[model samples]
Target: MPSTVTSHHRDIETDRHARTRITVTTTADATAVTVTGDLDLATSPRLRDRLDDELKLRPRALIIDLDAVGFCSSGGLSVLLEAVTNAHARGIPCAIIATQRAIIRPVKLLQLDRVLPLHSDRAEAETWLALVARLR
Candidate 1:
């Protein structure tokens, strides 16, 4: 079955005092969250909660696109890792797109790219997600 996009940009999550933009697009089989701006301690929790909530719905797959993220801190990395872990625990496929240096530098420095299902291309990630979801 072809997945349907129930909602795109359900809401643009951003606090007046914050510096991040989180756009969550939910589909029947997948949820794609595109985040821009800095991802630090203050902003990562909101994202974590959002991902956790999405996982609770038990989507077939989850995609986090962080290509536009300008800066990512340890707290942000923790959030991403935790999200992927949680999704896996629930048997949900999760993909993370981190093509920019902001996310790539730290993940590689920590050697986490091996553990986190890192993908540089969204199309490739989506294709993989579909294949994995189908085989499940």
Candidate 2:
């Protein structure tokens, strides 16, 4: 199987705010993880778990789509940083698709743009993922 996976994203409104729902479906040959919702101190752990799980799959590349994220906090930044570092260490590339300012603002504030590659569209992410997969 090719290094490709299907990811799903959804949004659920809560009393305080809305949570994004992410579902990742991948075959034994690929890795996929989807995250939806506000990634803050309270929710960052969930993302960290997902990233850790994906790393075990040893995917050629990991695509993290943030189009459905409503808000991002420092804790979220920490998880993202860890995921990026882990991916780099394992010779796996990670791409973040962020088209919304809510998601991009925190990343920019944390200077993550300088550390991780960001894609404005899925096509570019797919292309980058393929390239990274070949590197590994």
Model 1: per-residue Cα lDDT over 61-128, one tens digit each = 89999999998989999999999999999998999998999999999999998878888878878888
Q: Clashing residue pairs in candidate 2, if any?
A: 20-36, 20-37
Error of 1 at 10 (Å): 1.0
Backbone clash numbers for all candidates listed? 0, 2
lDDT for model 1, please. Answer: 0.86
Which number leads on TM-score? 1
Quote the positional error of residue 126 for candidate 2 in Å.
0.9
Please write out the lDDT profile of model 2 over residues 91-124, one tens digit for every residue: 8778888887877887788787998788887678
Stretch of 10 with least lDDT, candidate 1: 1-10
Which parts of model 2 are misplaced by more than 4 Å?
Answer: 1-18, 27-30
